[model samples]
Target: MTKLFIATTALATVLTGAAAAETIGVSIPAATHGWAGALNYHAERTIARLEEAHPDLDFVLATTPDSATQVSDLEDMMATRGIDALVVLPFESEPLTGPIKRIADSGTWVTVVDRGLAQEGIQNLYVAGDNASFGSTAGEYFAENLDEGAKVVVMRGIPSTVDNERVAGFEGAIEGSGIEVVAMDHGNWNRDTAFTLMQDWLSRFPEIDAVWAADDDMAVGALAAIEQAGRIDEMFVVGGAGMKEMVARIAEGDETVPVNVTYPPAMISTAIEMTVLGLTSGAPMTGDFIISSELITQENAEDFYFEDSPY
Candidate 1:
């Protein structure tokens, strides 16, 4: 017999008059960057708190380095743990759709966070940061601050649905603003990758005015490149995700790093918490839970700053 079958049979014999424990499986990408590191941090803490609070809820957490590993992790969770629910942040949209759909099809409640699946209606609860607003907020700042025909570059994150949404929002916001995007490329949301991409853009474009490093980690890389090129004063940068350091710089009225957009990595906590609540409390948790994004400027940066935050 399968382990799940054996365990269920044994539990039924031992707990004839008691409630059985339910399991939740959480699978996400490994901490490949600063934002992802923060995500893992929040997920771990949330899981610990929930496990302690709800003794009948068992959690199986897995961090995968890539989509293939994530797929394998899900298979193991199902085969061995017999999880009742699943919470996932896909490494990439396309590769994970089939695997996650299969899980959902097996009657396992699915809560998708951050990066969405390629297929729709597969997840019971969807929790994520406002990716479109995250982009548009930064775009609005660039539109208001830069002159007409000002040249700028962009650094995008890993190719996923959220990245697409953020870029679309940014493009739509700057449609008629006349702030030209001279170059755009993927930074994979890695500081080193962004640093290299920014270096290349600096060498090719001599008159760049601003940068929209879609992520704060990329912004740091781009800033380093700009400084190395001695072009720090010529251009400013806008990045999303209120990394504490980035918010601090904005609060101090730094000219090169003036503003930021909020895309908290802690949204993973929301997904895990809501999923557990839905399973245990029978509350209405179906549907999207989108947290809105806000711009962080010198006037109100203090409101967003978390001095003890890891991100």
Candidate 2:
């Protein structure tokens, strides 16, 4: 419950002092897309503010393009930096689990963010967006907005527990609601993959009443394909993760993008800040911190919009 404020000019001397006593390493995925880009932006800004607030704390941030690189980054952080704590968003669940467990076993406090590890109890703290709410919120929109038995297609993200929870929540929400999912496939959270998959679904199904692209990147691809096929007017698309462009469209009353469910990239800031507080203030931070998702409509889109944000 400790709050960190930006330090005033009086602490300028600490700015040039020796390295801080505690080192917290942050390893996250590279800015491969809009969502990840915003995530990186938030992480960096949070670390910067925390650094200024507490000169006794140090931070090491690494962005990895893949699981292999992320594993290597963790290894190097453990061996060379001798980080006292770690905040990691695993590239994938399975491959990074053992390596992260090894780090935890070595007495390092681990905080897992967003994508979870395959094995539980490995992290001292867990911070992430509510994947189930991310899905169910979108599903509820579909159930209320679409007609009974309306057909739709779904695009999933990468294979992980996060993706699984979202899909499961969606399924549970629409159960017996008379909404039918005509087709579903993995878009891997990539725009191109979703475009290709959407194109194929268009070819097979004569009618698609709506689309749940799940992530904003996949939503862009689905929209492109839908527009290309000249079926833009036939169905609307609902995506999660609150990409700035998509929220803007929703604000502008774009029919194709009527609404968005939020899974904020800023959750990284929560994890980093909490980890620092636990280390510096001796506060208890050994538990899950789940940030809830909300539905973004034109009525409140401006509240979620950030003009300065990269995503």
> How many clashes does each candidate structure show, in the order listed?
0, 0
Clashes of 1: 0
Please write out the lDDT profile of model 1 over residues 1-311, one tens digit for every residue.
23643465457547755456788889988887678888888888898899689867777888999989999999998897888999999988889999999999999999999887888999999998888998888888888998999998999998877789999999988889999999989999889999999999999998999999998989999999999999999999998898888999999999999999998888999999999889888999999999989888899998987665578
Candidate 2 lDDT over 65-88, as tens digits, reads 999999999998898778899999
Q: Compared to the true structure, candidate 1 yields what TM-score?
A: 0.87
Alpha-carbon runs more than 4 Å astray in model 1: 1-18, 159-161, 306-309
Which candidate leads the pack in lDDT? 2
Query: Distance (Å) between predicted and true CA of 155, model 1?
Result: 2.3
